[model samples]
Target: MTACKNEQLFNPDIRLATLDDLTALVALEELAFNYDRLSRRSFRRAIMSDGSVLLIAVGAQGLLGYALLHLRQGTRLARLYSLAVASFARGFGIGIRLLKACEQKAINTGKTLLRLEVSALNQVAITLYQKMDYREFGYYHAYYEDQSDAIRMQKPLRHMSVEQSSHPLPWLAQRTPFTCGPVSLQMVLSAFNPNYQATPEDELDIWREATTIFMTAGHGGCHPMGLALAAQKRGLSAKVWLSQEGPLFVDSVRDQLKKAVIERVHYSFMKQCKTEDIPVHYSVMPLAQLITAFDSGALAIILISTFRMDGKKSPHWVVMSGYDEHCILVHDPDFEEKDPNQSPLDCQYMPIARDEFEKMSRFGQRRLQATVVLRAN
Candidate 1:
């Protein structure tokens, strides 16, 4: 495969990988990694998948190195899934050329950010990434097949500019560990109704109305149905999207009595929603649908996992204010130790890449997805 003529900024030796390069890619993967090596089947899929691009560095001696880039669907975020340089070509600048080419391809495909995960112990790669202007954001525990941790890194690219929203954001800090859901609901309620008082008293009261019996530990968390009911009781129209039919977070509880209590509470919420004629869907809602609902003057409170933001696997709630082509703007209610140096403008509207938002919008091993949409009556 020859390099695309328009993308000839680098040496003509670099080109896109095709099915003919699958054997070479697998061989290179074997030479570069001991355990998490990509198999021939995986290489074949990458070469053919529309969502990914595989580029290779070639020379007179054949394949020198390769880089795999993944463009997430419905997002401006690209991920460098794998990068490897053959042992014989390590001293040469083939790795750097491959990396630069990958970045160019990402930009050409309308990506504003490129992210990748590297093993925590890979000092050489980490140094190279740092030199390339990639910054560490977070980490994943035991992410590799060998049980090694991985450090997540991201690099921003220059692209089309997105205008920030002029609409005022409602930002409120959670009063307790288990009150993020209620706080987020308060923020949404206030956004819809200027006179809606979002005080700590209302936050706790909403928690009392929506709290589940048990979460991973400590105090209980809010249920999607309970949150919808809470909003409805406050003179708002609420709709819920929950993927599971039974009680959520039940797997986190060990005792049978506690599990039964949680189940009963969930049933009560379901019965109430039905009696009140609130819409409930027993499946995950599409991102496009959610965005459409938001554009139609509805406010959203979504549950997400905090692992990407704070390295914890707890359920969290966030208020979705607006969206553009590049990112989804949110107002997070958990402002415990927000960077003091950050300005009010920064705290008001936090921008998260669309793909990252999707990954964070689920919790637990089962990947439970829940969201509640509300609008003033």
Candidate 2:
């Protein structure tokens, strides 16, 4: 076991994720975001998948934070999918430590660039990236349903070696999977940092201008809260078509809505896309029935929980956006979620996958599941 350099050592014990790590990872997700909004199944898949690069930070209690990287070999850039540090330890340098670990992995694999997107309003991340020599490229408007802009940033690994950073990374002698225990709910929920990209007022503005929007009230609790914020922004009426399970504990869903309409279903599916707020004036069907839905979308979902990084269950929220065949997206919103103040012109998006499009239909999960035609003006 090659040890990290003395300067690089925060003494953070690190390792790859394995089957046994699923419970811990899930707990971490729950802590990092509202559990009402995360998918445990996705965590399981990510920990066990070939494409996933999962790294953990071990300290006094257990795990302090984790970094998940998605590698696309064809491109030299490794996407920093998600990174989360327990709330108690923020500013203690845990995030920078884990980030170094990821950069080392990228360099070891011969990757040249690391690309990541943060909420345009995330000054902390932006400052960190800038300090790390990451350059800003562009912004995606309404990249998120909450209608926040995504600030894309990149760091060139060619010029910066893993050793060049103040922190040193340990070498893995023989790559082995890690295992841990389930995290506590207290640890999961208490670790959130609500530094959303835009101000509450900005969120209200985007919501007001939106004529069409999407929701995932059940999968991740963010949708419902997002809907409420959207409604407040636009002064437009908002509605939620949830599965029969009732409301999420994410935000105050009980009365946040002018109308908390329920859209019951036969089974509880992940990321089901049902509309709300629009009227059912059509002879054909309602608007809630026509939009496309899925178990997960390409955008990030938050997870909240309480468990130490090493113990494997801590309070925190995470953000997840992309997934593959067996897994859905999951992530930590350690900071506020992606920004929600971009223009509708920036809202255009195609399905991340065409196959998933068909699969989502088979599962009855589309954003516009039902098409309703109103009386012509």
Candidate 3:
């Protein structure tokens, strides 16, 4: 029950969890959830681990609630792994207080954004998160042990709302799972070329040009070089920037044949960039630099890992449609939307903190960073 020292305490009663509170935390967690409950061992590890911020809310009786925030390595994002309040003590503002405390702890640890997943059926928790300005960014099907779906959400710690620096861009949903790159390029092209009309056929055609589907395993994710080539074919100029040089996504494939095919596609796309206004550069661009490029009347399509947005770990493509001091607005092409009411809004003007983007921009073992800047010829 000791108070955290030195740091600005968000709440006097909310303090970092210690091993002594493990027994009480387990009891409170049991009363709060029926499935997906954290074990005593997990609680002990989280309390002792430097990679997480485990906070507990205390009242006169005992431990009233607890929150576990897991920080991702080499990233500025933290996952709200679990949060639970005692049933009898729920009427008080303990839940919100504890939630805010978790956010403050995350901010103290240099995390710019926080994300979590809640059961879609839990409207109470969802409403609370919404009231706190956490936006629904993604969804997971049959995610719970009880067969309940999960709603993925995120919030920027520093800025909860999009500022005046944010700009609106045309939104287009990817018709297929692996065509985000083409769809993102289409979104960018629409901003520069008024004649450009995005269609399912055109989307697929763009994907074919942007992907190395010869692997035959299934749909191959699109790469920046292919995206640049597709934009060139559409009479748009492009400059592709990469964090690393050798063929991207090679680490994603283990089969020698698959690797060779991907490498061949990579070299082929690289060779094609030799002509036209498309040029490739091997360098990591900072978030500010990217914002500057987008502000220069150029549209930038960037690569990101969906791990922070959803629970998936696949490379995703999104267009940087807007940028401001607090966050960068992205037009994500991939979406799992069942609500027509919330459709399109879920994918447009989605604000992400610059630090979060820094982590999300790189994907996989090599931490591949790719940005395709587009302009009208």
Candidate 4:
């Protein structure tokens, strides 16, 4: 599938569907699906429902994709009602983007379970959903009137309850500047509040005892858990940085990575770099600190991405490692976001040697960029 022009999917534009969007939405839907699909009138009613949500994706070129969410208020269950992408923009990851937007909406509304039904015949979509960790619950025989079987899938968001659960948000205690290689890095961790510290005996070890932690880097979700568990097996402390994404999204990811060897660390920031108070043991410096720390210590790096980054453009994650006469060393988690030809595997962490660093720096310096950090909170 060919994605639309760059300007069509690169813009940070998303909002709830309004009556004003009916004309454009109806047209797109009619063109993308068969007539048996819900009529415009039905679409209008769903949009107006209190427990339902409709999200529209738009770029400079206009409508790209739309997602409909059916949420059962008061209960923690949600469903992907429908999703459609503009015919011209099939390959640009619009479906996943719409799905993510719907997931975020469901989480924001306090839903803990997100489910969906996909046509069994659609192998492409089935593969994408499976790769995203949507488990098949069952199948409805010939559920579609057109003689198509339906695959029922579900994703649970247990960790999303962290905010509502008795558990509190993790906080930073103190940062001690340490050297990894030729660079200076600091370790960050959660600290007890002054009033809450009933006993001065509570030490870094107490806060470092993160029963659960989330990581949101490009590759963090896919691999760090293994390293973290290995380190924990050796009796080492580990923490992860989580992005403020949907609970279902985050929890689904955790389910895939959780192992007996490691425990989770609470860094307490969705946008890790933006948070000024970096957690103890958690370093904000990316590649520079990682290369240094990994060389001397076991600092595990997690790379994450919804898609591959385009080398022709600036990346989402950029870190300064060490500059030498020949080249620079860096680790880029957002490389997938920059690559236009991104796939599920591209979300993993990528290491750039000294030679490649100079090439990217020169490319990034010439590009204008901005980041819209979505906080799950």
* Candidates sorted on lDDT, descending: 1, 3, 4, 2
Model 1's number of clashes is 0
| lDDT by residue for model 2 (1-377), tens | 22333223366688786667666666777787541223566556657765558888866566677888766422244777777776655676777878888999987875666777777766887787788878775677876546678887777675533221111111111011110000111111111212323233442343333211212232111233333223323333323333223323322233334123322211111123233334222122221232222221111112223222113332122222223332222222221123121122111111122233222212122122211111111
Model 3 C-alpha lDDT per residue in residues 260-290, reported as the tens digit of each score: 9899998889888886547788999877787
What is the per-residue lDDT of model 1 for residues 1-377, given as tens digits with 9 covering 90 to 100? 34442233234388899999888888889889997887887788778887788999987567889998877543456788889987867756677888889999988977777778899989988988998888886677998899999998878788534443333557888878889899889887887789989988999899999999687679999999999999999889999999878888998889888899899999999999999999999999988998888777888899988887667888998888777676786777776464321223233445567788889897888899999989889
Worst 10 residues of 3 by lDDT: 2-11
Give the per-residue lDDT digits (tens) of candidate 4, residues 192-237. 1223331223322222332123333222221222223322332345
Model 3 residue 373 CA deviation in Å: 0.4
Candidate 2 residue 16 Cα shift, in angstroms, is 1.1
Those runs of model 4 whose alpha carbons end farther than 4 Å from true positions after fitting are 1-4, 158-377
Model 3, residue 227: displacement in angstroms? 0.8
| TM-score, predicted candidate 3 vs. hidden true structure | 0.59
Best by TM-score: 3
Residue 240 shift from truth in candidate 4, angstroms: 48
Model 3 lDDT at residue 328:
75
Runs off by more than 4 Å, candidate 2: 1-9, 34-38, 159-377
lDDT of 1: 0.81
